[model samples]
Target: MAGSELPQEALWQRVAGRREGVLATLGPDGTPHLSNVYYLADPATRILRLSTTTGRAKGRNLLRDPRAALYVPGEDFFNYTVAEGRFEVAVASVTGEPAIDELHAVHAASGAAGDRPAFDRRMIRHRRMLVRAEITRLYGLVHPAA
Candidate 1:
């Protein structure tokens, strides 16, 4: 409820573009932890996907408590979108494959740092976890006022 309501179409436009976002999670002691992470937004599904290692604080926090928030800032600083929801964290399987391997493809397709294979190898070696944020509440002014 922080910003004025924005149309979903406009909101998705702001999100679909390339941008890093701030993710906030709660520590075991109820302290807040924030991290800057690259993300993929599926406006069609209203889900946000992020890749992280299981040993990382954000991933650990998600496992302990599913609640979290991802704030995506628009090209204009003041225009931003915050998607708050519960996380579905899936640790890599025995084959060293994170559940949302397609997420790697998405990132790669979006011009990620390296090739998909290299990214996959890195994620596997690091015990990566794929997190899907099921948005419960969205906030911010993703679009300009008419």
Candidate 2:
């Protein structure tokens, strides 16, 4: 089957429906550090949110260099979307204030069931941070089964 661009809404739906993606950030050696991560997409704003520890390579690389790339898989191998742009790394926090709060928002948006307080505590214990990117460009192809 011939592949073509997915419609805007369909593209957003493809992105928003899934949580896993590969995030690419530039490492100190000028190499791409790709990480498999869970992300929350605000399709309306073209913003993506993710939680990470400050010490992780992806998080550390992102903090050092804001530019990044995201690849979200489609329903099958033939369909997928990529979002690319600069990202902002929120300050790592252990106070359960803004950083943990941002993580809470990401968790809530994901519709995952869990204890909020315990989640907050875990986030704090792990030196969690929030990563955000407002995509400057989006492109992908969709090929539905015949």
Top candidate, metric lDDT: 2
TM-score of 2: 0.84
RMSD of each: 3.6, 2.3
* Per-residue lDDT over 1-146 for candidate 1, one digit per residue giving the tens place of the 0 to 100 score: 24566876666656656458999999999999999988887767877788888898998999999888887887676688787877898876544254747557456755763765666666677787888877767777744443
The segments of candidate 2 whose C-alpha lies over 4 angstroms from its true place after superposition are 94-96, 108-118
TM-score of each: 0.78, 0.84
Per residue, candidate 2 scores C-alpha lDDT tens digits across 1-146 of 79999676777777777889999898999998899998988878878899888899988898888889889988788889988876998864565577677788787776752676788777777777799888777789988689
Off by over 4 Å in 1: 1-3, 96-100, 110-122, 142-146
Model 2, residue 48: displacement in angstroms? 1.0
Question: What lDDT is reached at residue 46 by model 2?
Answer: 78
Can you list the residue pairs that collide in candidate 2? none
Candidate 1 to native Cα RMSD, angstroms:
3.6
